[model samples]
Target: MTRLRSAAAALALSAAAVLPIAAPAHAESRAEAQVNAFFGQYRDAVLGQNPNQDPTDVREEFMTSELNTELDQWAADHDADPVFRAQNVPSGWSVAYGGSGAGHSTVILTEYWAGGGHTDVWYQVRLDTLRIDGLEDAPQ
Candidate 1:
């Protein structure tokens, strides 16, 4: 009887430990969903009107102030327009928790260019603000 109780207790403890791990997976899915929704809004705002238009000319009020400033500075410094061209590809988004807050996540997006080149875009998405605060070129 004692051995049976010990085995049951061990099983209960293991089950409790596994339950927390499952919760984070659900949280991560929610974060990825938020990123996808933001991208959908961006696609509508930039590409819905004119598919061939230069996206750099579109106003970026949808972005976080810091991200917008950094992108604008990059364009001004390089004397070239920076645009995020949309591509129809399979889901390749990956999200990591940023450790700052519950809604802070780092999202990796694989975006394709007009010339068939592909690049991964990294963004620090703060779901609280529903915007990306930082954007950087993903390392190869």
Candidate 2:
């Protein structure tokens, strides 16, 4: 009888422990959703527009958001105009991939040249961990 009680008690304890693990702390928050939405909007803006100034221009690219003006200015400074030309390929895409990590919505993206020729990558950025200026560090 004593053995039976002990076994049942252990089983109950184990079951209690297991149940909490089944559920996460909570659902993803509104902040996470908002951050992901922002990333999606930026990505769409990049992909939807023509990267080249002229259709005939062999190569061109542009990323005009204040969020990342440094890189845009850098491209302009160099001989390489932000342009890529191909029949059907996107000249450049602000490819943003979002995931939840460290209790935050994180993003990693690249300014990619079509056909995988070249890319300028950004590290992961976490939501709820941004500065006052709305910039988040890219997670390693």
Candidate 3:
């Protein structure tokens, strides 16, 4: 009986130690959550995993109208996807809170490409509405 109890206690302790490390990390802020969700859906659409959804529609839903217009111009001028800042879609991404000031917050999105490269896109979000208003390549 003593050995059985000791074994059960050891198993319980091991499980407890692993639980936190095994769990997925969550966004730390509302702005981070919004950007993470947007990129999740946008990536799916762009990859054709969600055939019924359009990536442009996803942009319109998350981005302000003015920013969307600016992105369109940027795309035309650069001949690339302004949001990803690349012609190809990334395989995975992660979002983190950058900072907040002047009624706006920044979310840094790091996109990982299949070809062994990554890009950090900084998104400016309106704090009041929690809407993404601007995005640009990471400052040099």
Candidate 4:
């Protein structure tokens, strides 16, 4: 969970290039919070030997179902992280969160670990709204 937060901070935020965005008036919205919590629980589920159980993909692009094999192949070919996990833990307020340009109102965090490799993930939020946008490598 801590790592997920860290990843969120890292992707949606940086020292220099992060343009300012408005913050939510009441912390994370109920919808956003629910999505965060939901994903947080599910992403962790893949870390074990649990076989493919979901009908979603790392991008929630459709990892399960009849397309499962295809999505898995794509992840491999693209070096995409399939088990990355993330959540929205609240980050105070902002003025640029009007959900303006870039479809930046959603956020997704994903964590991936393979053998002794370091876990990896990419967090993304709204460049305009300052909320989670899309987890780069998350399962739906």
lDDT of 2 by residue, 1-140 (tens): 99999999999999988886555554544544443444444444445553433322211121224434543455466644222212233344453445556654443434445556544334333354441112333435
Winner on TM-score (2 vs 3): 3
| Tens-digit lDDT track of model 4 for 57-83 | 333431223334544565687675333
Cand. 2 Cα-lDDT: 0.42
RMSD of 4: 17.1
| Candidate 4 lDDT (Cα, 0 to 1) | 0.41
Q: Indicate which candidate wins on TM-score.
A: 3
TM-score of 4: 0.31
Scored against the true structure, residue 35 in model 2 reaches a CA lDDT of 39
Q: Encode model 1's per-residue lDDT on 11-56: one tens digit a residue.
A: 9999988886544434554545655655554555454554643344
Q: Is candidate 2 or candidate 4 better by lDDT?
A: 2
The per-model lDDT (C-alpha) reads: 0.58, 0.42, 0.90, 0.41
TM-score of each: 0.51, 0.33, 0.79, 0.31
Across 3-34, the per-residue lDDT of candidate 3 in tens digits comes to 99999999999998888765776648989888
